[model samples]
Structure formats: C-alpha cells, structure tokens
Target: MGISRRATAHWEGDLKTGKGQLSTPQSGLLDNTRYAFSSRFGDEKGTNPEELIAAAHAGCFTMALSAKLTEAGFPPEALDTEAQVDLSMEGGPQLSQITLKVKAKVPGIEAEKFRAIADDAKQNCPVSKALSAVPVALEAELL
Candidate 1:
C-alpha cells in the first residue's frame, strides 16, 4: 500500500498584502503560514514558496540518497541533507537553482566512494529529476 500526505492552504486579500495559513491534516498542525509579497521582497514572520520547495527537496533528496546507499551495500548509519531553493522574482516564480548538501556517516566507506555515492543520489533523486529545468548542485561530506 502507498502512503499519502495531505496539506491545505488558505489565503485572503491581495498578493502584495495577503495573508494565508497552511495546515497538515495528518498531524493536525496549523503550523504553515504565509503573508504578502513583503516577506519575499523584504520582511519576516511569513512563509514563501522557495522555502516550501526547499523542504520538499530536502526530504526527497534524503530518501533517494538512502535508497542509493542501501543498493550499493553501504547503507548509511545516518544521512543529513539540506536543500536550498532559489526563486527569481524577475522570472515570475521560476526555480533559479537548487543546492543540496549532505553529511553521511557510514561504516567501511572511503570519503571518495561516499562522495561518488552522494553524487549518484543527487543525479538520480526524484526531486532532482523533477527540478531538471533548474540547476542542482551538491556538496557531500563523510564524517
């Protein structure tokens, strides 16, 4: 069986000054929220699209990396990944770039081999494939 996730967003007012709320149905948490162009352009206390993409990219990349490691007979003890998504306002919400950074601690793996594994993960990751139009860069470290 396949698992599913759900989230909902509600927005009000104009784009330049609107406010919104996002909630996770499974967790019953109303944690996600948004407000105006102000935050993206120049303010805090609000969420933006790039940040949300970063979250998704981070999750998807980590899962992909883990799968790759397992397949290569070197399953990671732990994998820490972060994604930074850049959005260009000039191009109207275009994904300018994505940076993926990973730190993995695995037994019996050389640093060079680990780096190669991470590169494979980055290339074959579903999120990376989906964001193929945008540039995806990776930095992997074994510790």
Candidate 2:
C-alpha cells in the first residue's frame, strides 16, 4: 500500500475576510506560512479549489495514461500531462471547461495509437470520474 499523506488548513475570521494556513503533516514546505488568505475567498497566497482540481487532473491523467500504455503493451518512456481548469462566472461556482494536454514518448508506438490511448485515459481517469459534471477537452500528442 502507498503511504498516506495529510494536509491541514486553519482559518481565522470569516470566510470572505479571513485568512488561512495550509500545511502538510510530512512536508515542511506546506507550513502555515505557505498559505494565506485575502479577500479572494479569504486567501492571499493559498491555493483554492480550482488549483487543486487542476493538479488532480494532471496527476490522474498521467497515471491513467501510464497504466493504459502498459496494458496496451507499449509502456511510455515518458508521459507529460497538464490540465487547465477554467472557472467562468456563468451562474454559480462551476467548472466551465477543462483543457488537458499530454505529450508522450513511447518507443515502437504509432502517434495515432498513442493519441487514442491518451484519449481513453482522459475519459476514464479518476479525476475525470470525479468531474463528470464538467466538460473536458483534450489535446494529445506523441513524440
């Protein structure tokens, strides 16, 4: 089993005018000083939900693509995934769109096949599952 990770956040004052600290139990880099709050959701340098979602998308897509590539007998030499989450003020706090881009280097694999595999990963990654309410677009390339 993988090791568990923990992060804690502390907030002072109200949600809009308050400040907060985000810390990780195991990493000093996530110390209280690393996070702050501002009028923007009561945070200054602290990351918000959208940033977290984009990070999740990047991680999930990379792992899913790796697994899919291995299962297809063309394990990737390297897989780079990035996600851009767009938060538009349509009606509520909604994820307007997500753009996923992946660049993969897999020996002995055709570009089209690699792109298809990445597409499948995009559709089935855990982040994708968790974000069914949002629309996700993909731009996959194999090098």
Per-candidate Cα lDDT values, in order, are 0.82, 0.82
User: What residue pairs are clashing in model 1?
Assistant: none
TM-score of each: 0.84, 0.81
Residue 33 CA displacement from its true place in model 1, Å: 2.9
**Predicted structure with the largest TM-score when compared to the true one:** 1
Number of colliding residue pairs in each model? 0, 6
Candidate 2 per-residue lDDT over residues 1-143, each given as its tens digit = 88666888788876566667777779776677433335234445567667778988999999999999999999889988889998886796678999998888899998888888888998999789989899999998887
Error of 1 at 64 (Å): 1.6
Q: How would you encode candidate 1's per-residue C-alpha lDDT over 52-115 as one tens digit per residue?
A: 7798888988998888888889888999988988878784768788999888888888888888
